[model samples]
Target chain A: MVLIGINEFIYVASILFLIGLLGVLLRRNTIVIFMSIELMLNAINLALVAFSRFNNSMDGSIFVFFIMTVAAAEVALGLAIIVMLYRQRQTILVNELKQLNG
Target chain B: MIDILFSIFASLVLLSALAVVLNRNAVNSAMFMIVSLVATAGLFILLEAYFLAILQILVYAGAVMVLFLFIIMLLDVDKGENFNFKTRKLSLCATILGVLLLLALILNSFSSNNLPSVELFLIEDSSFIDPGAFDNKAKAFGQLLFTKYMLPFQVIGFLLLVAMIGVIVISKKPKF
Candidate 1:
């Protein structure tokens, strides 16, 4: 039998990811949306680390390292874009910035 | 003992994540995000990834969250959008859908028959592992990173540089 303890980490990861997804879909605030994205990334990292631990390998952890680097870069660029967007539009609500719908 | 700790950290992570999503104040949400991230780092340590846990704290909780708070303060947002009756209904539907999805993942489909049965007791001790072991220790990570993953490591460095330049250009006030 597959022990419940073994798969519990995966379960938590899934829940965390779902919460992040809900955040992105429901929140109009751009900053909160960005935070949701970070939460999702952390969830994936948790699952990867769990898998690495179970498999007795280092590959997944290494992959997570790369993921963190990418996440850091993405956050810096995304926030910069948000700042620039705010400068041009003077608002950060997603719904209010539909000028490109044309 | 480890399982108990795991449950605590996981619950902490989920609750704070929910707070991050549901909170109206951007600053409060960012603070909750820090809590969620740090709790996730705790989970990493439970998984025996000490190096990753530290990186999670330093890079994610420390640097990334600070940047988020900085942007939030710089924007000086007056108030968050209110969830009217329509959004409340929409969120209700979304919550139902998400809960169903979680049930599908955790209940019927993810049984042991489909998964590779690795021994869970390997991490029971939760003590300091010897350096020679091929676990998630820092020494082993360095060896693997320097050997098979060297090219990708360099590529990630270049990607960071590119992202830095792009951010600088995008955020700068136009000279003209």
Candidate 2:
């Protein structure tokens, strides 16, 4: 029936991760970088679930909880930092954020 | 049966992922990211991880994406049309590099032998949730989370509390 095996999921995850990587490297918007980071995290989550199914273990699924928690924390802190930066700098563009580049 | 569903969701996830990167507007990127998230959650359901699927939709697509949109609107960050993230030459280089990396990953994947296991074995005495059943995945997930993974659960709770304080601290106006 469902023949999408474990490695296929991994391949999908890797491609998503690479896409996120490209976004991070090529896109200069801080928000886009944050979104890319989330994309990468989701890719890891996919791999974790796929492996859990393949191994018949619930441990991998449990890891997803931890990952999501950390991701939430990251987003909270990251957005706060962005907001703070915007208050000081007036723009969210990455190219203009060079005051601290000593 | 399930394969068809999986293929559909997987492609949608990838498509929305591309939208997240390629869309010029921050709001559009955030919305497409939510689409990608829900699709990935659907794939999780196809893997019989019903709890994770629900959690994915609820936590990520629901709570997290909302926060993203809130931040985007609060700052008025996308008022004007701005497009140049990098020079065209740099973007071209990045595209070529990313494609090369993808090709390498796909080619490398074909030659490897996959792990040889598929039978699900549940922890003994966890009676309510049958590991192989179509339903009750949440029970198994809760059982594991409450028992074997209790420490991490509590730890994550503490992490959330600290993160809340940190966010408030980071966003406050500096008193000079």
Candidate 3:
């Protein structure tokens, strides 16, 4: 008598992903956008775990472990880049960073 | 009982996530992000991924967020700017696109019936890889990592090493 359905989890994940997408699109700060990307990754992880549990497999959990590792590495690198940029430009606003557009 | 817990955690995740996005202050956003992450960890517990739940808290909520806070404080961008883009057109387009995607998801979800219904008790009682076999969940994961997942584990280690060197190089002041 499971009160919850797989589709419900899927829906929650999708909505969370959408919220992250909206955050990425709407936010002006670089750090906030970075957080939005993390949120997106979290949403995908939720979906993966849900499917893994429903399907009775440990593969999805393994993939999640890998994703978390990659995400940690990505955060370290991305923050370093942000720090470097701030050292030079003294600001982290996304709109002000248009030197590469030309 | 589980349904209530799931709903509570789900709503907590959603609200905190929204707060993370909507908060004007970076520090506030970071704090809210932590809340959102911990709530997601709660969802992981509901999913019976005790190992992942701990990792989610330790990695995402603990380590990664502390880094974010350190950077935020280091840079001192305490005052947040306007939430929306300066250009009205761009903001409108983004909002419209997000709305459309949400609509599509909802429509498809209602229209589809292919997802199989599963019994929670059966999943909990039997199908999950014999929890007692390895005597410990962490041990089970370790065995899998050392055996079936050996290559990827090594690759991840290498990737972490590369990332470490790359960070040092990127952050170091040039010595010209």
Candidate number that wins on lDDT, 2 or 3:
3
User: Backbone collision count in every prediction?
Assistant: 0, 0, 0
Chain A TM-score compared with the true chain A, each model in order: 0.94, 0.95, 0.97
DockQ for every model comes to: 0.59, 0.59, 0.62
Report candidate 1's fraction of native contacts: 0.66
2 or 3, which is superior by TM-score?
Answer: 3
lDDT for B61 (candidate 3): 97
Error of 3 at A68 (Å): 0.4
Return the TM-score for candidate 2, rounded to 2 decimals. Answer: 0.89
Q: Which rank order by DockQ, best down to worst?
A: 3, 1, 2
TM-score of chain B of 1: 0.83
Residue B136 C-alpha lDDT in model 2: 28
How well is each residue in B1-176 modelled by candidate 2, as lDDT tens digits? 86788788889989999999988999999999999999999988878788888899989999899999999989878754378467788889889999899888867776555444344333354344544323325776677778888898999999999999999989888889
For residues B100-172, could you state the per-residue lDDT of candidate 1 as single tens digits?
Answer: 9888886745564656556654533222354223365576778777878989999999999999999999989
DockQ of 1: 0.59
Highest DockQ among the candidates is held by which one? 3
TM-score of each: 0.89, 0.89, 0.93
